[model samples]
Target: MNTTPVTSPVSNALAGWLATAETRANQKNEPAWALAKRSHAAAVASSLAFPTRDEELWRRTDFGGLPLDSLDPFAAVTPARNIDDLPVLLLTRLAGEGANTALVAQTDSEVVYEQTHPTLVKQGVIVCSMDRAIREHADKIQSLLGSLIATDYDRWTAVGEALRQGGAFVWVPKGVHAEIPVRLMQFLSGAGRLAAPRTVIAVGDGGSVTVVDELLSENAEGASMYLGGTELFIGQGAKLTFASLQDWSRNVYHYGNGRAQLAKDAELQWIQVMVGGRMSKTNIWFNLDGEGANAFVHGFMFGDSRQHFHLHTLQRHLKPNCTSDLLIKGCLKDKARSVYQGLIQVAEGAQKTNAYQANRNLLLSDQARADSIPGLEILANDVRCTHGATLGHVDSEHLFYLMARGLPRVEAERLVVEAFFEPVLERIPLESLREQLREEIERKIG
Candidate 1:
């Protein structure tokens, strides 16, 4: 790993802000364990080299034009606002009637609002801010915070962990089953500000939970930056459904790292929808560590204007009889561009493992671009692995067929594009959320 300090203007600005974050953490009376981790991450971030265009992972995506020094890493938190101001669907999902869900909302650095249903509280489910978790659920938080997505994954991960101010922590006890989902909303409100949130979710043996995370901005005016991390742990025989929706303003730049670890007989279903952000880069990983483990990852992306997206995924099978599947689809228009890179690895002892990966892209305009790279590494001869990628334009015959049936040309094209994404959209568990995504897609298609 490269440890030389980066000399870019962005790196230097981040270094100065990280130093200030350490000072603030010390003065806040933070727990010793949490403080130590933050300090170590900050040091690592300062020494690590920033990603350049030469690196294979970043060669296609450019970050050279970003004015990193103009963004504030230690911006002050704005005052809290009423939940009524948010969208009706989001409000219903977060704190709806008869729903045993937990909700946490953060703006800038502070957790402006947090609530947990009383019934879930009685069942030993913990849903609160990271700050509160560090003070109240110290043992559980310390054991799982950086266990999955370690701080050293890259400079961005280290920056997110070191400077993170607030996020959600959820724990479901053994044998407990949460019928309703736990929801977290992180909103960026001001321009030239930085938002870094770290989320950790752990389900005990035989337990189950559904989690939904949303990242949004008020509008598409001022420029902002978002650096975030997420870790999920599923114990033996446990099941988890995780979904993330990112709709930041067109002026914001976002980067995130997410990971999940599964034990024997554990199952994980992950869904990600990306429809916003000026330039976004996200990396997701899954580890199957025990027999009979299963995982499924699905993602959707839509980009317009000059927006850029770089998405990467990894699936690692370390035990026997494990299964994994991944499918990511995107549509690009105008001058937008997208890149998808995926890898599936089966260890030597991971016999009877089955894995599949695919990425499909649709170019809606002549100037739009999309790149897909899918790979597999199998050390076990008995295992089965496959990978494929496709990049194509809208089928002209299909469009013409729809137009001949009394639909306008634009409407026909939109319908065909919607059909292209329906396979992934139909898999979303929530009807309301699915409809919301459909509406967003429709708006973009127009």
Candidate 2:
């Protein structure tokens, strides 16, 4: 690891925060192993320099305008007293009526609430805060944490891994199948505060589970920042469905890294939704490391005002007879901008691999901008790979036709926008989640 210290807004702030976190960890008698990981992560973070616009991954999204120095990494803020106090629509979408699911809610830096169904516990499923898991389930935690997306993957990842105060850990034992989803919500509150959350999920052989993770804010205040990471491990013949929704305040800057590893005959369905934030960048990666493994990755986003969103995805096939499909869609209005980059890679000896990727963007305003880039890397001869991207404005004829049907111009345009996303939305498995997303998209378009 690089040992030379760097001087920058992000690095300096993180260094100061690391010291405070270490002291707190010691005072709280946290696990030594967890603390050691944080210490190592801090060193890695200190040695690296902040990302700049020159980097290919960050070339289109500039973070220079962000007021990073003003944010407080260890700020103390109160979380919502109860789930009832949260946005009704959001809670409804997550917990549905009479749903028997495990739920976790966090604010700022700690998990304020957690609950798991009795049957799930009886079946040996574990769902709780990462802190608790680290202490009580050290064996399981130690085996997977930092195994996929290492703590030192990047500067922000290091910051999150070292300083994250709250998150969730979910595990489904062998042959156990969870009928309902596991839900986690992380809400940011107070101005100038920084929120870091980490999530780890593991599904045992022949087990199945679904997860819904959300990032939201209490209210729009001064500028804030959120750094988060998620890792998913699917065992042989296991199935996992994961969905993540990000809806931070317009004054917040958000960065996230999500990754998944699939074993032989395993299946994974992943969905990502981005709708809020002043500037946001997220990377999603999937590795098919076992033969007969399959995955489907989907993403949706709507940006208005001056918000900016950058989303990148990678699908890697490292074993023969594996397949992966990916689709990302976005709509931008006003002066909003979006950037999407996707890659599909078939490693050597990974024959009979099938991979597909596509990205589509719709610009609602002349001032709106969208950049889409799709790439492929194939080292195997008997592999099938295809990628494509499209950037276009809303169809004027479609809008005019709707308007002529006695609907107002705004309503007509809204309908057109909804129709454009119908294909992607229909792909979602959960009916409640699909409807909730549709409602949110409609609300945003209006």
Candidate 3:
């Protein structure tokens, strides 16, 4: 019960919450070093200015409006659902295909499933719950988790670490290439409560794997909240394809973070399709660590009504001879607002790296708002980097021509959206998945 005094009640309460999480971490037998890392991050995050109406970055999104700290809907663990309809079957085929990859899955509350493909098992791949990874693979787990994107030691993130409940852990063996994608799904049920979905995947040198994370709701439009995070580490010469689909309940407030580290000659491809959260903020970071590394990021969002979706991307080039490219597009209507922020960075010694970033948006109505801010930071003299952002409305001429051809406004817009999204969705490697994803985005637009 060691609590220090703070200036604001909100800050004080936040401190108390962190203390509680630390106590739980100790109770769970987390090593002193792990707890120390959490404590240090908490301090730094707490000191940062809280977004208010005054801050330009958050003004458009309006965090001061939500009662984020008072939302006490979080639970420790959730039980598995016995269901008839399985999620995207073929995605599961990767796991059933024989373990060239290890898989770990935790629902809102508990570790519902885990598997190490038979092929991967024989290769010494270890995929299990993050808790187990922390406990058994203590040394490895300690080095990666929480070391990526610094979690803003807020009520939401503390709730994430304190009641983590369950999450996946993937470790690929050096030189092994997974033939399929490992799928992880989190479905919010009636026992519906706040869920923090966390996942960490590490690829050994020359190894490869694909991971799919799905977030959906049980009550078809139920109200829920999810604070989720993901991190990927690609060993030198490895490859990884990570897809994140945010389809939580329409009433859920979601904040998500995805990150990756690319070693020499490694490749990372990331895809994000945000369709169902009531309000969401997405932040993704890619760090290039070795020469000849590459990263590609693509994102699209369709939001309507009061939905507010924001995305921030950072492509950091830390080594020479790296290449990274990003393309993000969003469409909004019915008073919804969307935003995109992209920044590309080249370190002092990151010479010979080529980087590019671009963001585009389509506004279908006067009330719908879209923001695009693309920036670049170059520290190396010989590196090449560029960024671009565009925000515009559907061309009236295009709309008129479509309508003249007997297409309805909705259908016409659908066509335009499809065209705009194709550049991003086409990059999805799996055909079946690509089709289903296009269908989902179409439905959301409708």
Candidate 4:
């Protein structure tokens, strides 16, 4: 137990780290407002201290030996001149054939490759890196970049904004339908590097779009970290489906936060999938702010070896007649562990709000562990809110029955685990994504 005490953000160690990060921020040569935003974010981040084990939110996940201030802020990368120069690992991970309406590839802090379908271009869709968006579409992004997610909310978020490098920005014009998903592949190849990517997606009135964002890495010789953030805004009567998959190598520590807001009669489908990382913590929130708005949240995690996963979710209803539903399932093998916490809150005057949440975990080995906490707070009189959590191992009888049918023990267990996650998989609208998730799970189980 190395309880030397967590260092404060204002400590000399962090001040040095901030200076390193600021130097990287200045290298971007962005506009004046963008530079000012980064400086302001740095100040805000400095005011918040790092989370200690004493904090309720971080009590379960151990943070020992994690490098918070000693990391190389941003390792330099040779920018890819074109798509052909992109890494093969990244190119192979693209969605199934013809499944992507646009593709964006990133290596470290550079956007290496970007392409959008001609149809999408004609429909007034904007898909490009954050740098280009700030230069070309500042009017649209100025008000919404950090609006939904406040910089000072937490340690991860505050520092994420200050140090975030390259990110993808997406916009769907009113009434346009980007039916095919857009894929964003971000890969960190630098050892001991700290990578932070911020993404924002906005859909105009009556529009719809689907985006698949993948945060991944190749096998690294040394440990690294990823601080990521995402913000989504769904306009009136619009629809947006956002799927984020975290598959960093086991040598990475991952911290991610995302917030989404829905307008009147809007629909949002939020999906989170976790499979890699030595340790990971993710926070997600969905705000139903207009009457008739609805949101569906889905998440799944598979951990093996000594991996640790912590997932937190919030479904908030701020207007009458708004509805939200959430379900998250996870499976662990070896000495893996997971912690899940979820909350459903209905604010005052949010009458007729309907909300539901559930977290289910399955342990494959006796050494595996899972902790689930579900809660609800309702200030409205006419709201229906419910939450549930379940933790269990594979049913012996079910495995025996499968084995009796001439199946091997390992095969039987795989069958049971696959069936456990089938419900959530069936809800995914993209076949390619569902297949990719299954493939990743199979790799983990084996």
Candidate 5:
């Protein structure tokens, strides 16, 4: 293990936790390289300060009182004995998805179950726990672990790097196509706990795959925090479809960061749904690094009570002939509040680049509020870029039209909210999953 410098900041919350980095790695039976990585990240994290409201991205959300020093970073859970032993919230969300090509489940910070189809295994497809991948596929993990998102990006990422545990990893060989989706489920419980999970996915040239990531939590008395990160790498001519849904309990604070890099002729479809948690902040980014690369993003959220949700997105064009589009819609009621910021940036030499961004919000209560900010930065003269945003209350004409019929006021409002998100929901490829999302959105409306 590397020696910790005496001059590093000792007042940071993660400084004390860094002292046990090596011991925790050894207890988990991790390899020497893994321990070395953890030690290096811990040393860096100890010097970094937690985020504050001064930063532009952090201005809308504040996590200063999250009780990081009191939470147990390495709280553990026993492995499940069978599928029936998994968290009920996770099982219920997966009820109508039918059969998946592969499935991985995590409870608290432990990976309890992993199942992959035999055919996918024969085709050189790999889907398993990140811990198993670190031991079995050390070479690959070593090369791509921090390739897309750096370990020292920010306070949350730095701490997550040093303390992340029990995640999922998926790899698809060249020229193969997985018709069904690969499912990843996570559930967090207990108070005064911190759950940090990282997922890495790579698709070889000419390969294709779909992934569904879900997060849930059981009710608890005290507050808990969830920090998650995801990285996706698409090779030349490859395709990837990703869907993420988060529904943590009211006592949980959620933070997520997701990014992807696309090669020449690559394609990506991204979908996001956020409906739960007392306060949440999320960042989604896509880099079009290769010519002819294309991407489309769709996202929606529903908030009620005193929930606060902040979302940010970036569409970066680094090569010529690249195209991207993004749309995010949200609804808020009661004392709920939301903030959305989106940017489309095009590099100097990236000509013929086409990009678009739009954010729309609906206020369902007098006290509800929302803010939408959309911008563009195009250095290329021949590129086409545009953006638009709208924030308004529910259309009274539409509500009155439905109410004049036989529907009640509450039911009319529900229908209007559902219709507002219909465009985004229609993009989902799976019918069963679409219906499931609809049901969940309707539940949130109430």
Candidate 6:
């Protein structure tokens, strides 16, 4: 075990690595087009300071007590076993289980496995490794790839763009709906290394596609960190359904976000499932530029044993007749804590916009804590925008009712909490998935 001991953010090792990363971005042989992206990303990442107590978001969260000095990235991870026939976690619910869904798997910044079902491939559906996309369809991919979450400023975002490897690039051509889903999974198998994960998805006019991104640590080993960022574009009258399952080891750090655009009459439904990670932060934002666009988003998170999961969602309505409703709820136990902040924005000309956001949490123990903030910004007088947040301990009355049924105290509390969350889980739309997620939560709480 190479326990050199992790260092603080200010360590000299991190400084040197940052410098080298900049050099790597500016190297020759790199096409001129990607040159600016790498250079700009490097420059931004070079000056990034670790968020501190002074920062509103970082004040409450700590990065696993890292050293005051920066630490070097760990060795790259490798898979020990093949995943040819593993039961797909959430995607198995779709019609064409393994036949129609495309898959892209990667480890330690290297694409280890990538396969697209031939049927979907022939449908003009593009599902392949992002690295390959950058090489084959550079022009089309480059134009819309990072447009949502531009790496021009944020340090982490820049690092992800500049050093990103082993991710997926998906494009659904006009009027084509993959009757089956296209799935992308990332496995961080290397020892304690860092993986920059990036995903770019573009849906053409009247096209529809469902995508699921799953991140897991192979065999639940290693202390790896994955910084992932994704961009989504839904063209006019298109529909895009995106779901993410993040289940890393308990000692890893995971941070990511989704930047999306919805053209006229485009519809997007996004669901997020949080199962693991010692500490995680996720940010998602949607631009409702097309009239009659709709976004239905829901999130489920479970935390335990000093784990922390923080999420922030932004809904931006820039056109009339756009509608968005968000519901995110979580449960905490074993000294774990989490926060959910949702923001909804309606522009001045976005009359008739309907935006509603809600976040609720149920803490199972006194030691567990949850903070929720739901906010709204409306500049249109004719818009209906509402936001609400609720934080409370497990319902004692519900527990009492369960206990009255002869259930033990611990069991009663668990039942009540489960009952409280079933409404949200039931909305998942997939039967097997809904039940499977229910089991995961049951296991988590028990």
* Candidate with maximal lDDT: 1
User: Which lDDT value does model 6 have at 417?
Assistant: 73
Q: Each candidate: RMSD to true structure?
A: 3.8, 3.7, 4.5, 3.3, 3.9, 4.4
Residue 32 C-alpha lDDT in model 4: 76
Say which prediction, candidate 3 or candidate 6, comes out ahead on lDDT: 6
Better model by TM-score, 5 or 6?
Answer: 5
lDDT of 2 at 223: 86
| Cα-based TM-score, every candidate | 0.94, 0.93, 0.85, 0.94, 0.94, 0.88
Ten contiguous residues with the weakest lDDT in model 3: 82-91
lDDT by residue for model 4 over 7-30, one digit each (tens)?
A: 564467556766776786577567
Computed on alpha carbons, the lDDT of every model, listed in order, comes to 0.86, 0.85, 0.74, 0.84, 0.84, 0.76
Clash pairs for candidate 3: 77-109, 78-109, 99-117, 99-118, 99-119, 99-120
lDDT of 3 by residue, 49-135 (tens): 565657555666755544445433335543334221233332343333323334455545556656666665666767777777878
Among all windows of 10 consecutive residues in model 1, the one with the lowest summed lDDT is 92-101
- Evaluated against the true structure, the overall lDDT of model 4 is 0.84
Spell out the clash pairs found in candidate 1: none
* Model 6 spans > 4 angstroms off: 1-12, 15-30, 67-100, 218-222, 427-435
Error of 5 at 187 (Å): 0.7
lDDT of 6 at 324: 92
Worst 10 residues of 4 by lDDT: 92-101
